[model samples]
Target: MITDNTGGLPRYCHPYHGGWDVATIALNIPESRILFICPVTCARNICLNAINGGYKDRVDVLALTEDDIVSGSYEEKTVAAACEILDTVQPRPKAMILYVSCIDAMLGNDHSFQTEEIMSCYPDVTCFVLKMCPITRFSGDLPLVALQHDMYAPLPEEPVPHTDTVGFIGSNIALHPDNELIRILQDAGYRPLHIQACDRYEDYLAIRSAKVNLCLMPFGKTAGELLAERYGAKMIPYFARPDFTSIRTTITAVCNALDIALPDLDAMEAETVRILQECAAYIGDTELVIDSTATLFPDILRKTLTACGFRIRRIYADGVQQKAPDIDAGSIQMPLVRSYEDNENVIAIGMAASSFAGADKTVNMFYDNGEWGHYALRMLAARIRAAYEHPRSAVQVRKEARK
Candidate 1:
């Protein structure tokens, strides 16, 4: 979580980086294989991530040599590597995610050509050309965003007959069974589909039959739009935020999109409030800390927790656009760097925060775990209380958060 004060390459900490990596996300497609074509230096860490992520069996590496790049033979080599995997790998993959590193981007490799060649050779296999290029991190379309879009791009463009099914895009973890959104849809006789819910490639392709596509995160918005345009479904993006007002707005939008009567949220809001108050009372004056590793918007989370009567002592994030001064009024905003002593009284919300503070009381929440609306608030409170009552070491918390 170190801030890059020097404009050079940013530093990466393994333990602090939670949630699924690009390899894991790519492999989410059923019966999929990842062929990462990059120089030896770049492939090492990605291969390690895939191995550590418990998906090494599905991932193969094609290490690029200096001659391959200099002689412009890397493109052909990449296709050959993918074809070799398709031929030799037992029970051929239904889908293949072909990855290229920053070097390929710099050399202007034509990925479309490679994709066409692969598909032409193996018509049964779906091939997606994905970039591992981190040089475009600040660009509008980062690798993760592109991956989300491409993963679903393989879905048929031809219209499928509409069904009561609704698709939820962009969450690595499936929404909780008791989540308000799931409950509402199920009660209304509509089936909800998420990538995590699919056991087979056919189950995933059924997303085209959905009348509406709900995007759970901002990164999945592009994929939702693609589904809507290609399959003629309504695209509804309710990027999850823990705050009550935001949750209400999301619920209203979803109801309007579905043309269903809005469910009363007052009771839900009250339950969330009650839970928060209980947790806060138990937590007392313990110093609470947050970090970006746990969530995309640490400042927004800080504001939500502060408004819920929990006094957040500090926030560790690389960069935060202070939305409001009052929410961050007394809380210290520090860079995501590990530079603190162990403190039993300090409760940390994220792995990075716990690692930095060395706090025993740590809540292991990563990327919100697909939680949203009032349900998210209640779950957060429950986690906070649990962390306080049964303190765990930062290492144990971090390990659980990653899984």
Candidate 2:
């Protein structure tokens, strides 16, 4: 059931998508401070989001004025602001992100020159400039893509080698802590590098040491490229293309590049089957509603879940259309929904879908994040188990998701 909007564009999309986007992810970076240098008006939503996500203190805004815009001294002012932040903030910031808004897009200011001043002044705080122009979404970098690149901006020009380290780049959150991906890497004698796994500048700097990068989500593809260019590591992009058989192939490719032995694929497949059996037993007849944002490929994951004996009611996304027709899957696409009052006995994945579906149970699978491989299965099963204890209101679910 598609709700028609006046324009051809879908109501729920990037820039206006209901849940959190890259800006939140950027602010949540470890050992980093983000100073958003833009209009004060840009402050409210980001601040509210920061508060809700429990990281309000990590972000600050340097509101540029109309006079500054007209005088074209925004760049100079931005440099000064960085210096000020360095002097005032105790312990100093390891890195500062100078986020310029779309209003200043036309200025076409060369940010690096301005940032050089900040670097020269403080010589301690590592900073980079990021353009936050929504208008450039179609033409250039969206904040998500740009943040992925900037996150790696701190990589050292001359990296030290740590052959046993493996980096997981480009997912919003790190993979599930207990994920077999970690087990697989460990069994093969490689350590995993997740941003959150590091607390100090030195540990974070060691991101440069990974022998290979696994781009689990689409957003990470460019980050993987940047890492490859800087560290000469191989890039293996899964990019949310969900299919365990295909994913295993990609993992094999990554292992070959590192000269590490591949994990036991047959055992991996059996473990996945065992979890799905548990999901099927618990799910029973509960309708499973998927939102594209919940997994890298909703359709691909839909196929996988159905094979595990879950019932898919509907999906709140356009992704199913991109794949070849599967008569057996019988999946249908619906636009962003308003209510799912009729579907109470549901297991909803993705915040938007869970909000709309009003499922009795919901998983915190916001925009796929690192929900790939068996970790995806683990997270899904865990959500189902949690719902058995306390169910959430669809109204509460959707409203909280709007941030």
Candidate 3:
């Protein structure tokens, strides 16, 4: 019996990132009504979130269950259910999205055939299918998904545009609400042509037209490379970390690539310094110990947190690919089992359980909320502040206060 914790990776890891092999088909036709069919365990969360984010009217979601997996007739039933839902809804969807799960993959269910059958029955509705192959064994690797996006999205209609717009690529999972990159670009007087990760097919096809591309996360390297090859676009890679200097470096590189005059480094440096100073106040003298199934934000967090005066005692990161050389070596390496003493100062960062033998706090940093990467840093800073302001209750006494 294999027993691996399903909660290893942060839930906010974007669906578009290749951590799960999701297949997408774009119909030239605009989709008015849509349906999402997925495994029972994963469906409610994904569908509800999408609905909360304003896709409810056009979207209908249903989950497949264990019985369906056992019977192998679930696919047919799922299609029938979707059609029924469409009929009940009155206006049928122009496009349908069939989201298959790991069970479907294991059963070797032919989604294409299911789609064809559905099409023959309801010829008016355009149909599409996507597969979600969870990277439980491999964890989530965003670059792999970015490649898949490149492969699945239709080719551009015209030659790549030669505009000054830059392509911003990364898993939407990693983006903060403030959208730091967009702020920086706007501050620097440049307009971004494309900011991918959750963009529609048309936007993806327009990526080749950008004058250059800025890869904010490693997961975008594959897509960036593809666009460069096809459209002569140059790529500027940046990792997530809150260092003002790093941000400045990124901006400089981008400016150079676009032939835009460099922003005053002194001014940029001062602004970054101010942000770090404020961050330091929030993160003073606290110690953190993070463990993740993947090295999503460790490097950036380490650099930024260290600058802000926090002590990183240890990190247990897993599922690291050899390709991510930028990851810090001093941090705990990947594929590690629990081996720490769990001192009072330690606070964990990834999907690892909070109940490890000796840790003071097992904070869950990533989850399906699609805001893990952004929230983790802020949460870390807030925890540190709480600890300093109330040392006696800081260790474990003030759970409600922390919240």
Give per-model TM-scores: 0.89, 0.86, 0.61
lDDT of each: 0.78, 0.70, 0.52
Task: For candidate 3, write residues 1-403 as lDDT tens digits.
Answer: 3344433532322121112122212221234344556666655555454454555565556766667667776777877876786567655665566665565555766677777877787887656565555643354444345343543233444565576567666444434535544555666566665432433444545566787877655656776776677778787876554455666677677767766666566764555455545756655555565544323655555666677565766554443323355543322322234443444554554434232324555443442223322333455555545534443322243232211
In angstroms, how far off is 245's CA in candidate 2? 0.8
lDDT of prediction 3: 0.52
**Candidate 1 lDDT by residue in tens digits, 98-200:** 8778887778777888988999999998898777787766655867788899888877778999999888888777889899989998988889888676768
Best-fitting candidate, scored by lDDT: 1
What is residue 26's positional error in candidate 2, in angstroms? Answer: 2.8
lDDT of 1: 0.78
lDDT of 2 by residue, 93-146 (tens): 787778777776767677888777787887777787766676666666656787
What is candidate 3's CA lDDT for residue 209? Answer: 76
Model 2, position 58: C-alpha lDDT score: 71
Q: How do the candidates rank by TM-score, highest first?
A: 1, 2, 3
- Model 3 per-residue lDDT at 160: 52
Give me the runs in candidate 3 sitting further than 4 Å from their true place.
1-39, 42-95, 113-127, 135-164, 173-180, 187-190, 193-208, 229-233, 241-248, 274-284, 291-295, 319-403
Q: Candidate 1: TM-score?
A: 0.89
